[model samples]
Target chain A: MDATVTLKDVAARAGVSVGTASRVLSGHSATSPAARERVRAAATELGYRVNARAQALRSARSHAVGLLVSDVRNPFFADIAHGAEQTALASSYVTLLANANEDTAQQDTYLDVFLTQRVDGIIIAPQGEGRGNLRALEEARVPLVFVDRVVDGFDVPSVTADNAQGVELAVAHLAEQGHTRIGYIGGPPSVSTGRARLSAFLEAVARHHLDDDPALITAGDFRRASGGTAAAKLLAHHRPPTALLAADSLMAVGALAEVRQRGLRIGEDLALVAFDDIEWFGELDPPLTVVAHDARALGATAMRLLLDVIDGGTAESVVLPMRLIPRRSSAARPHTAASHPSV
Target chain B: MDATVTLKDVAARAGVSVGTASRVLSGHSATSPAARERVRAAATELGYRVNARAQALRSARSHAVGLLVSDVRNPFFADIAHGAEQTALASSYVTLLANANEDTAQQDTYLDVFLTQRVDGIIIAPQGEGRGNLRALEEARVPLVFVDRVVDGFDVPSVTADNAQGVELAVAHLAEQGHTRIGYIGGPPSVSTGRARLSAFLEAVARHHLDDDPALITAGDFRRASGGTAAAKLLAHHRPPTALLAADSLMAVGALAEVRQRGLRIGEDLALVAFDDIEWFGELDPPLTVVAHDARALGATAMRLLLDVIDGGTAESVVLPMRLIPRRSSAARPHTAASHPSV
Candidate 1:
């Protein structure tokens, strides 16, 4: 047992041939169920991990990478994924993607899966504080890069947008349009984007000398339904802001619906601006004004960084610039529309 | 050479220990590159697969499933993925997703990857003819299920929408609204949904005695850019149709942009209907009327079928129904909006 326990040792202990033990370890279907159970038990008792790690020792390359997106349903993230995937394809590596659903637990599960899958590298739009699998990846020296968002303590190479500048542009535009109060719908404080954008909103509002109402800010989990809930909360305040700025596009959609349901109109009764300029934003009734960041570029850059890391090259973190696209949703308007038609 | 070749034979041929041979076969990265190359060459020369098939014999369950979506960026497929992932998670299984990007070659690549990963089952929105990995999946007796789209000539269990009926509803609605010709933006004919929907449109037009102008039909590769191309082609016709029916949400978005670019207002200058009623589709300028299919249900159903197949149960193919949701996009109106407002 002390002399490097192998499949032979496990097979001997299980009273099965080495071939049977090997079949059981390889997960092939031709072996008897009884043999499977016995060999597995024997392997477990002998602490035999060679089955999973055997081939990993021979070649450092898996020709596969792990991509963890915060939410696949978010058009911004989806675009980023497309860009990353295309770039990876050009490099002859396939990406295995996992949706974190913006939950730390799901993120941990997928990172664990990626390690077990023995991928060569990883790119992630990280969620929550660095812990669990995120920390494990760093410790294991897995090639890693962050995209869109970064964890607080992780010094991983990343491709993130300048949230402060983007927020300032949106607020300055609204302030020029004579809006003294703006409701802010933000993502949870757990994520880096959420903290950065929210902080920027606060700074921008103060610089513009807008109303410092405590009720003006609400947070959502960055999912569609939570966005709706946050929007509703912001609107229910006794003294609601004359304009709304959602930190992400999904929340902006919810805010739009909430405003329309109240028989108010965007670009008229209230001004609106959102982060993340999705393509369909232009097709909305009022053409949502946005703090536009190239999501696809962020994804593509992250993949490049990961590849560099995999090749034993140094990877530098990148912060992409963001801009505001002015549209009808933030245009100054006369009091015209109150009742809205169904979209 | 006459007897069965084993990992031992390959190890002997490669001049490595049995443990080293096993490590190389298991894809472990800890072994030396030279050892890996030798072992691989030896295994190939001896036709040694016993090591690869060994663990597969244990339970034949990797607790992983493959989901090959047509396009992950499409909101419909994203919703489906969410549903399938949630369902799989509830059953303590993980799903490995791949994007075909509406390409047959990409589909083949992912299907082959799934086999090597030893996934317990696979759910695919298949593209092109039933060859390559599709045939390989059947021959290998891997649990397989199709969703959203299906390939011809394969008797695989599937969860597909009634595409013909969905198309029929769209055409009939347009006919009842007094449209003589309805422009159709459809997917490529290589996919089942594309063929079935197009056929249904043609049959419906004939039944209604509407003009059979061939210019009314145009096909896209099921991406946003192609949708724009098809719509532009349709609108450029000498006698353009009053109504438009796009095959999917992304295409509909492209068509909407094209229509607006031509200074046409939806529900006024041109009636538009589409398939796949995505969540935000209702939030478009004129809420799109759609032959709505439950995309999430399709995904969840496909996962259930795959699970059934994995459990050795006979999986019956499921065909879900589609319905029409009337919105302003398809409202009958005069051709009034020649100069559309920038939205």
Candidate 2:
């Protein structure tokens, strides 16, 4: 039997027109019972399976969605991809996952590929403000959903974490621990999470009456190397912070390396807190303090939103709440017990 | 301008046939220079973009490859995916990654989907021994390459780590450290890595004149929770081993948790070693000793082999070498120094 048997072959064998055969094979109610029966028999006899590309060309529905994450190696994004892919699979939709590698140019390249692929929809953890293929996707009127981060000027439904609340929780805990000078390592300002979290950190710092020194703030590309660079800059400041907070898990790992290289001990000499909570964070020697949010839920929710949009239904944006989990990394300051009686 | 402009529309505007327009647009050398120029002008004027699905149908090539990993959330597989996707992109091909979630059924489902999507080739970290869609894919003559694991009786080219060498290295290291009774936490026997590593462990132990107690070996399903379960079983043995070795990173993590829960200090009371070296392994309190293999290189190599097969070239199987990195976790046995006087 020929493996590449087409619909035309089935139609010919069924003694029916290609249109009637297609309708019957696609389970369209418009087909007569007799025509459907003949087409079914012919298809079964010929061992003909529907060609997904041809079907997609005809119906304009590929039954596939593109999921573009900032970085695939990042555990947070990996969890998200797992969640989204599983959710999409449950709906009989395949997810084509792409990694932007935290580069805006790479993100744009993937967005263009996704557009060309003509996926039913797209869910993206965007890298930059609205530019390049991001604008093209919007102009093409593709059903789009943002996960974790969003582009500016795009009115797209998104699933994001509560950056302000997470920052507040971490800052408040540090304040309670009598850490008056805390360094901040954040993501690049081009990204929504970076902007939102940095602003939230500033707000939290002001609310806690802590040192609001501009020199205490630094930014990375939300990657490990950048985190180490940011940490180095903050630690070298003339009035260095006693504590440090990284906006993401990779950066936190990088910051930890820098702190260790400087002969400073986490949870003892300097306090540290990270935004995302990875599985192994708790297994670290002194463990780690983290602002926790569900990365899997973020991906799942973004997929759900994309599915809804694909079905021609509008979806509302979702902002998930965050909480702080204090571990040994942010243990209370021993020296502060004398100066700050509250400690 | 209409977004769905067809080649026929461009052909009509160019005063040429649809076939001429298609050949010109697809960069076929058979097209006349005049027709090509006219079709290009018409296509540009009408803002006509070739639909990827339609092109795939016409060419029988999707210019996409499906990569099905055993587990997406596993850092090892995630790194592999990143490498494969990046390599595929460099060749102007997109990689559609799917997570098998460590289940055979899920692997079959994704394989079938990849077939339906008419991908040019596929790379998989297979779960079971030559069953389900694996057979179907083989019969269909799809360009296939195996990464990390290969099924029995399959002639498929694979890029796999030298499991025997890795296991031998770990076993010898433990033996040299004065651990005669080493408990092994291995992957399920059904998997290639699991079977190969276990057999290698047995052979190494017998060669070194160490204890070959069957009770010292336990198997997990190459997952975290399974590792913990296996560890629990090993630790509960009446004559428990002084040191433990996990076959994979996730299992190692699980074993670590189990040891911690029992208040057994790693490196001091119980030595530990893992097969794969994750990035943060060195950052652990006592750090982790691991048999390290380049997961990214494995993925990249698999993809290159697949592309070779797709281009009608026979490719050779690649066996990547592994090395052991000794850390505090697998430090020398303290009491053995006095008793054996070999330190």
Candidate 3:
């Protein structure tokens, strides 16, 4: 669907007058609740794209895009920001990055800042429910594209990694390596990627006929320290998993330290794999095996999507593919074939 | 010094009227060159701190600070940004981060954005000469602080690593290993840290009476790929050095790959020490010895200093100390005493 769909099309589909449809789209309180709902549903069904340039023609163009990241400390997000900013700069636009620091309130604050700064468009690694400033952005008709995660029921385009595929790849690789009981350290369920990957892990393990013990699973807040904490808990179990899968790179780093502290060698005593790939990962003692996601490309693609929206073009959401890169971290031989009870 | 020094005091010291002093300080084009010179010199001498809060009281507070970093992809700056943002958030201020990508033109673009955004203040890890936006920031009386790198002749508060001390520790440790022919991969001389570290390296080599050949020193852009290029040039020499020192962690990571590609064993074939200490360094095969600088503390300190200035509090610039962390990377056995040109 292109930007050819207009308010008249939405009005016709909603069975409302063009004036009422325009009023509802403009967020006018005079509209009835039923009419508002119909107009919104009709707009979504018709794939009616907002003409951001037309909405913004009243003000001079700032040529600035606000990029709100979940966390600046996360190297994955940092790489994404680099890619997005470089792409924006190439198009003569500058990206002003704000770190939500993985907090909803902080995200709201930056959203307000972006609005007041009059940024031409915004690209966010969104957090929390689609309320408050996020809703405000849609109401204000600001051009936006979600980068990593997306909120439910939001009519926003996004460029995100295939989290389910990544989790399945990591799990199948460990199962093939004779690890029947694999410890899974996942992210908080509140985040979309977190929930998707965790669900994928459970499904993949069942497909491989591996242990479904509750003790094998743990969740972290997608940060480094949480990974360490989760690893510690898993290792202290009576029957620890022979292999470990961390949902992200930061958590994996934390897990590596915890494993080393317990005098267990990675790739040997405990096979390990993480979700994201960073350049320095290969420098690790036994290079880290990872489910590789192109974070830079994700950022670049998101910017392109946002620009298309800003230029009155409609674009589809992108789900980038992922692949597994095996290194020494998960390449060590198991003691015997008996470790794989399912096979 | 304190913001107590007023226009009257400056004018009196410079033998000019209060109106003339105000014009010069306000960057009024009507001011004479001599008057601007006298006013600036007098202000510097009196340590006339800008009262950004007072100047900004006329405009509604944005409560947002701009933090311009050299490179977001560099983990060092990433850590610094995290620390600064967390601290800023604690103060009920949000940080807007812009990546210069190690380019001066990019730096200018972001500076303009910050200015137009009406940020309460700015903290920059600066590059290029002390001109353009760097000068505009000073003349505009915007509260500013330098982190990691400082531009010369800018009387801005800064939080920077002790380059001399860091270089001394890394060089002395390597020298004690009886490896006199050490290769140094430094940063571009245009950068402050780069120049300081290179000068320190040259002096230390002279002090230790080691190989002072110009070929022993090479320059990179403080990025990963440049480090690889520099390492390739160094290793392809008529006789490669037994020890190598990369000025920054990114460059060091690149050197690691290059050394490995050349089939050189890091700990056994050549001793290596990097300047910045990152968490993953210890996870490298044989581990890495480093000159440790707390990047988080550097960032946190710079933010605190910037906040103090915004609050009209006088504070001294900080020169943080550095330490040496010895690991297997630099614990290799020397082939013979003949490796020491002086001894």
Candidate 4:
């Protein structure tokens, strides 16, 4: 009836040596069948629950993985968590999800906690450059996988969307609408996704022969308020852009609010496109145009790669493709009839 | 440099007893200052990392709590998780979040995993009656708090919204707009919120002296697809209700899509109201009217309560109030100008 019934108690009840009891309980293949049967029966009779931590120390497996996301409130990350958790459950492994809240310090704190917990593996949508606890985790040689984003010096297997292709699709679609002056709201440069997408956007603009004004590029922290602030600055320019693109969905919503407050229609006055696709984006009056990728698939793939690493198998990094889903947000420009086509 | 440096090794290196080293490392106040200093030096010299599970067994404190939500993808629950994690982090604790995905079997599995992990406490938006792992958790007397929803027989401290008041407010507003027949799309009765809201809707209809046709009430699993199905069923009736109220935000979105497909303008042909407000709800061409509650506050309060229980305090249950935010979706009916006032 005591909660702290130990292996010694089970061993005594089974009339076996402590070493034999432990090996049987830890599922060691070398244990005799008779010893395993007696130890199991004794454990059941005495209601001896195995101390997971102690057992993990002996067996080097906990059957639990840690998933660290940049922000839990972001729908894209939420969808990813759902996919990863479901996949983990199917494999009989529990996922312990932690939110970094887009803060590098918070991400480090969680990485330390995951290490302390001794999870079988970890799948992370990393925040910034791998440093601090991330370095410690790598030094410890824990099974690790990157989801959606990766750190600078880490040679970890990752599941990420093709940022270059996604950016190109958005830019090309906007260019086809005859908008030569395109403004871009990008994420922070500290994050991999932010840097990749920004560089891709610049490359796409040059390839499409659009205006390359320095003032056209603004940055946000991948949050809604930053989108609003960035949008305000761009629209206040001497000659504002005819079209705007955001790096993420939250920022896009913020930009939409800003455009509305300034009495500008989304499709009519300024064309808008967002990087990530979300369910509610389609519900907006003039639904948003988005560079779409499967967030759930990304999460699921990361989980599978982590499991493979845990099983001592090497996994190749996967880069999923992206496509443009043009809605009313980037409809044809009214005056440029020759270059634009109705969508 | 070994990852498995034990307390015995630290004690041996420090020329002290293992008991003294363990007492010092576990922060037992009874340890002498000299012993504490010696153990600290030896631990640092040997690069000793305490196994969290082993320490949890000895100290019976893990500084980690499990939070089980019905669905991680739901913005409402996601907000709750954000609030809870922030509060936990402020207290120098970690939150291990698990998604039940609205399935009782999955909920039980996560609960079992939480117990095995030896979390300091748990906060759950529980599903179904108190059974399986829920009962086992109660028997174990692990510090527990319910958030948003509660089980039938558990006396756990909880933070929940006033579902009755929320439902009554929506129904009264619809009746005031001269909607004699209002359709109700509610959640499954297995959940506490579902039962509370359904009964409240029935009571409000009686109080307002409006039509209470049995055919007007329908239920869903609190999912988007179920909402669409329920909406279709209600709308197909020979005498379809003029106004529709969905129990949750996802269901509201489903109903919105259904209404649009039927070519019925929300504010003109049919009035729609949804429970649970989301950020994007306001961005719709005709913004949704919602029964609003602070989801983040609900999560924060639950974490605070669970922490109290963990500290062996008798925490009181909290019931958060809800209010109606009337928007374009529930604006005055065009033909019933005399009974309705413009919103």
The top-ranked prediction according to DockQ is 3
Summarize candidate 2's per-residue lDDT along B1-343 as a digit string, tens digits.
Answer: 6778977799899998775676677665556889989999999999998887756654766668999999888999998998898888876677888888988888888898787667889999997887889998998889999999989998899999999999989988988988898999999888898899999998999989999999999999988899889888987877778889999999999899888888777888788999998888988877999999999999999998987677445789999999999999998483632242211
Query: How far does residue B274 in candidate 4 sit from its true spot (Å)?
Result: 0.9
Model 1 C-alpha lDDT per residue in residues A1-343, reported as the tens digit of each score: 3438876788899998765676567654446889999999988898886634544542446667889998889999999998898888876668888888888999998888788778889999998789798998998888899999888778789999999999999999988878877889899999999999999999999999998787898998777777678767766776666788899999889888877887777888778899999999999978999999999899899887887676445789999999989999987432232122121
The list of candidate 3 runs beyond 4 A from truth reads: A1-58, A336-343, B1-59, B336-343
Residues B1-343 of candidate 1 have per-residue lDDT tens digits of 4348876788999998775676577664447999999999998899876633464552455678989899989999999998898888876678888888888888887788777777888999998888888998888888899999888888799999998899889988988878887889988999998898899889988988988998899998788888889888887876777888999888999999988898777788889999999888888998899999998899999998887676445789999999999999998542432222222
* Candidate 4, superposed: residue stretches over 4 Å from native: A1-58, A332-343, B1-58, B332-343
**Candidate 3, which CAPRI tier?**
medium
C-alpha RMSD values across all candidates: 16.0, 11.9, 10.9, 11.8
lDDT of 1: 0.83
lDDT tens digits, residue span B212-297, model 3: 98898999999999989998898887777888999999999999998888777788888899998887777788799999999999
Listed models, DockQ each: 0.54, 0.50, 0.60, 0.55
Q: Please say which candidate is ahead in lDDT: 2 or 3.
A: 3
Worst 10 contiguous positions by lDDT, candidate 1 chain B: B334-343
Candidate that beats the other on DockQ, 2 or 3, i.e. the better one: 3
**Model 1, chain B: what is the TM-score?**
0.81
Question: lDDT by residue for model 2 over A1-343, one digit each (tens)?
Answer: 6678987889999998775687677665556889999999999999998887756654767777999988989999999998899898876778888889888888887787677667878999997778888888888889999999987789999999999999999999999988888899999998899999999999999999999989999999888999899988987876678888999999999999888888777888788999999888989867999999999999999998887677546799999999899899998473632232221
Residue A126 displacement (Å), model 4: 0.3
